[model samples]
Target: MRSIVLLASACVVTTSSSVAAAQNPAAIEHHLRYAVRVDGQPDVAMDLLERMRSYHVPGVSIAVIDHDRVVFAKGYGVAAFGGSKSVDSTTLFLAGSISKPVFASGFLRLAEERKISLDADINTLLKSWHLPESKFTEREKVTPRRLLTHSAGLTVWGFPGYALDSAVPSVPQLLDGTPPANTAAVRNDTFPGARWLYSGGGITILQLATTDITGEDFPTLMRRLVLQPAGMMRSTYENPLPMSRRGEAASGHEQIDTPVPGGFHVYPEMAAAGLWTTPSDLARWAIALAHSYRGERGGVLSPAMARQMVSKQMHQQPPYGEGYWGLGVAVIGDGDSLSFSHGGRDEGFVADFFMRPASGRGLVIMMNGVAGGLMGEIERAFAEEYGFGAPPRMTRTIVAKSASELGAYVGRYVGAAGKDTVRFDVSVAPDSKTLQVYNSAGRR
Candidate 1:
């Protein structure tokens, strides 16, 4: 009986809402009604409701932009685990590192206003705190261009954020890795402009710089420069959203659909992971960027500056494709077919947005779960359903190899991960059928 109760409670009965899709009802209905993906040889369409349940995600909100407009923006499932509030188009979710692109846009807007220079040394604009000098900077200085491109050589890959009621640390404390802050010190890990290495820490520096230069708080500055202009009025860089706004926000959850005690975490690292927003709002921002990229009048950036923002700053290796990190967005594909995108992950929340700058077609998906595999599946479905070509189809040839050859690759190794050392053991099956890898704890 207990198992039955648990199973019943775990089941998801999601019904999507098209409150924001009224303007483009047909397009929205078509997208919500059908979810398609390739099943090896043929196309398979699954019910959106069932997919959410199968993935154990509490809720999801999506906004699809096409032909320079948001054709669909809707939400599915409950806002909280075992709760009644339904997620809708207006539901706010953490944008995570997606905050970077928005923040980068603000930076460019500030540049247009002549408040800061992208190529200038960032230390010149920051007054409250400055990057501590290191061997990496002796020959080269960190700039907004490098920082936004993840070539700043800074530390702290990303922030895990703080609990809702926990004491939040100041930006300086976070950068210095002091008390009340969880991550390590945000410092130089390599020479500046050396390569592409993601650093929420580097963005944090920009956050501070923006504040110091503008003489305004990060959120307020962003509103004046980027969000308001881009028509993302519902978005804010504020962390731990105001009490009044909580009701409109989706509560976060674990992969198992268990509610986080507090609806969401408080990300004081606003530039890196803090942004409470809706998919519809993000879609608007994407549309504005697309317009600006085509040398048209955009809300915040000039055409030339917008083009520069999406231009390749550095080359990124495979797994991300022959990708390139632009100012703050990932540029994929080439020439007229290029697209810009970014993914965000915070405790109990995950999100991503993709847009074709030239074509004005893209989608944004936000969910309140730690495990985000469902987002990718939904994206694949969107690609097929809406004809957004180039969903990553794996194409590899399997080859048979001798047992001796496989055995040679099997070995034990040790490596340092953060402050702890870990061991890994690689072994081939006795029957020579497969290989298994084990971590320090020995569980595969």
Candidate 2:
């Protein structure tokens, strides 16, 4: 399994581009009104509404921040298909893994206040369910710092969440992977601090530790330490979001354009994937981070801590070769061009945010359907409008090649690394100048 995973890892490179400063609302709106285009395909352009319709996304909300302030925020489409409620700046959508960075900010505040130490063994702070003792902990103990950076060597990359009507697991039950909990037990598989691997299970441990330390529920603690301070009034870590806010919440839609059972799955893994927020609220949180990074007062995190939050903690290994992991976000670029970002995907929601703290610029995008590709198109539109350079353009430059030149590359190739072997065949196209590659399945 490991070798197969390694072979698959060698097959792709992930690239992420940053967004620039914001412009006037009218100009930005005008830019969005025009057709969004793919980087290399000039003919693939669709107007924003048309694109949304084609992608089956029922609703989308966007917020742009420039010079440390939200310059534009709006929503398009209905909160749920066939519903009369329209999405607006205040409409809430599940934030999925974006919850990590937000939760990290609150967790750091605990560290700042001297309530918890980032480097202390997590067992010392956790009173609810202890991280089970294992061989992986012999030398390096799992600590808050390691968990924040996803270097704790823990298992469970993410959760599938519970159906709205299903029984929800307690934090301890979830961690132990007992009945009612849908994931495997959260335990160490590799030596802690050896490498970077994303583990939402690790963040769940933090959630338990935080609640145990503060003697407060996760939602309350986050509101007091992070959301309220950061002016994210519309955000909440509550699972099965309260009924009072239901009218303002967008129903999650599957990729097929149908709403999820009972509107959406309920995520009890609140610290990792259960946040509900508006793009505007997320923008506010991003702005607060920028302020703290600049050493300004009245921010949730201290300037020093905020700096570390966005600094590179560890380089991500292959398959995630695009960037480094900060405390809770992905760090890309460097120095003046540096940016911190995170993307999230739940059962029926997709959200993403990018912020260039050095320049006080960023954008938050939230949608109610599983339209991952559409999110990229929207992001590129924002990039072009705000002048954040487009993602590396993929251009196909045709060069005249002799038949012999193409023939030289036409052959069957087999490569083995350890016990795993990869086999593929290459053949020239009918045009003779083009090449086609096929795997063992004979499909290109």
lDDT, each prediction: 0.77, 0.81
- State candidate 2's TM-score: 0.84
Off by over 4 Å in 1: 1-43, 318-322, 394-444
RMSD of 1: 8.9
C-alpha RMSD values across all candidates = 8.9, 6.2
Residue-level lDDT tens digits of model 1 in 11-74: 0111123113323333432333223332353444556667777667788898888788888788
In model 1, state the lDDT of residue 434: 69
Give the runs in model 2 whose Cα sits over 4 Å from its true position. Answer: 1-45, 397-444
Q: Please give the clash total of every predicted structure, in order.
A: 0, 0
Each candidate's TM vs. the true structure? 0.81, 0.84
What lDDT tens digits, residue by residue, belong to model 2 across residues 276-318? 9999999999989988998987577889899999999887766
